[model samples]
Target: MRVTILGSGTNLHPRRAAAGYLVKTDNLFLMDFGPRTLSNLLKTSADRHQIQYLLFTHYHADHFSDFITFFFDAVCHSKFVSPRADLRIIGPKGTKALFGTILRTFPSFNDSEFRVTLKEVSTRSFSIGSTRVTPVPVTHTDRQTCLGYRITFQGRTLAYSGDATYAPNLIRLCRDVDLAILDCSFPKNRPGEAHMHAGECGRVAQEAGVKRLVLSHFYPIADRFDVKKHAAQVFRGKIIRARDCMTLSV
Candidate 1:
């Protein structure tokens, strides 16, 4: 399977776009549609209609703000429409309500030209095609109940920590996975309230025995530090500092 980091920046960072990822097998699957998601996807050669699944980790603006533009484009453009498309959107408990609010807030998206099935995901395992997905709750903020996902496909596993502080569940969820895409939002020395720093990410990867560690959701200030030096301290495997449009195969 191939995984692409579509957008790898946090909400507050303008140099890098918000979070988004594209996982491809026989079909394409999108995870987190942030502010620049549509534009980032357009930059790629991949067809938009190929996306069969959309998974939202949380409702934070950086994680989900681009859904409006994506819906608009998909509804208005024929080329982007999937002929046999069954777009399955999975997220936390309030997913349906959040999507309903989006449609209500934007009348253009309310038109029923396309088919979208919204599903709620908690700390449980579920199936999407041949892939098995497990959601693990993470500590974000009191306002939101965030989740990190571990996706197992074709005997390969990839874990994604969706914008959260260092938590034990994250380590457990990522254990033995081929790749762990972590939220290394801050630099090693710097501190943050709801995001992981480079040092913390390294320790987690070490404990989890993750084969590869990809650091993302980078803040602009994080660029000032030596990420590799910090992450290498604990993680003994491949440590990738993700850039927009970077792809990884596992």
Candidate 2:
């Protein structure tokens, strides 16, 4: 499996774009279509028209605004150029209703040349082609439900934490995975809410036995400090500081 960090920073960042990660194996899977992420994805060799699944973690604007442009391209451009297979949008509960609202809000997105399916999942395992996906609830915001995905394709497994805090479920979800793409929204001891810091990320990586720890979703303040150094204090494994368009083979 190959994982691409399309956008590693948050909305507050200047140099880095918001959350977006693409995982490609037998199929193409995307998580978090934040602002400017599509522009970064276009830099890669992968074809956007061939993306099979659109997996979301939550509905925060920083993590979802680009979906409008992505869907628009699929509807208008890719339809006649390089028509692909059905687009499967998988998210937590309320996904169907939320997307229905989007479709209704935009008349241009009304009729798609191809089929678009919305599937909601929480604490449940589902399959997309040969890939087995497990969606687990993670602590992000109290008012809205958030999800983290654990996907297994072929013999490799990886987990992605969308935006989360330190929680036991998050650790359990990442246990023994080959790669753990965690939310390192801040540096060590940085005052923040609803996201994990670098030190906490290290502890999670060590405890979960994650072979590779990918610290992403950075806010601008994190750039002032060594995030990998902080995470390495607890985790002895490979720690990667994510950069836009950085692709890693898992």
State which candidate has the highest lDDT. 2
lDDT of 2 at 135: 89
Question: Which pairs of residues clash in candidate 1, taking residues 3 or more apart in a chain or in different chains?
Answer: none
Candidate 2 local lDDT, residue 16: 91
Q: What digit string (tens of lDDT, one per residue) describes model 2 on residues 33-76? A: 99999999999999898898999999998888899999988898
**TM-score of each candidate?**
0.95, 0.97
Local error of candidate 2 at residue 53 (angstroms): 0.7
Q: Write the per-residue lDDT of candidate 1 for residues 1-250, one digit (tens) a residue.
A: 8898889897767777889999886568888988886688888888887677899999889999888877777777643443446567889999999887887778677664667788998888988778888999988788898889998889999999898787788889789999999999888999688888999999889999999999999989788998867899988999999999988997
Deviation from native of the Cα of residue 133 in model 2, angstroms: 0.8
**Predicted structure with the largest TM-score when compared to the true one:** 2
Lowest-sum lDDT 10-residue window in model 1: 78-87
Stretches of model 2 off by over 4 angstroms after superposition: 78-82
Q: After superposition, how far is residue 196 of candidate 1 from its true place, in Å?
A: 0.7
Q: What is the C-alpha RMSD of each candidate to the true structure, in Å?
A: 1.8, 1.1
Model 2 worst lDDT window (10 residues): 77-86
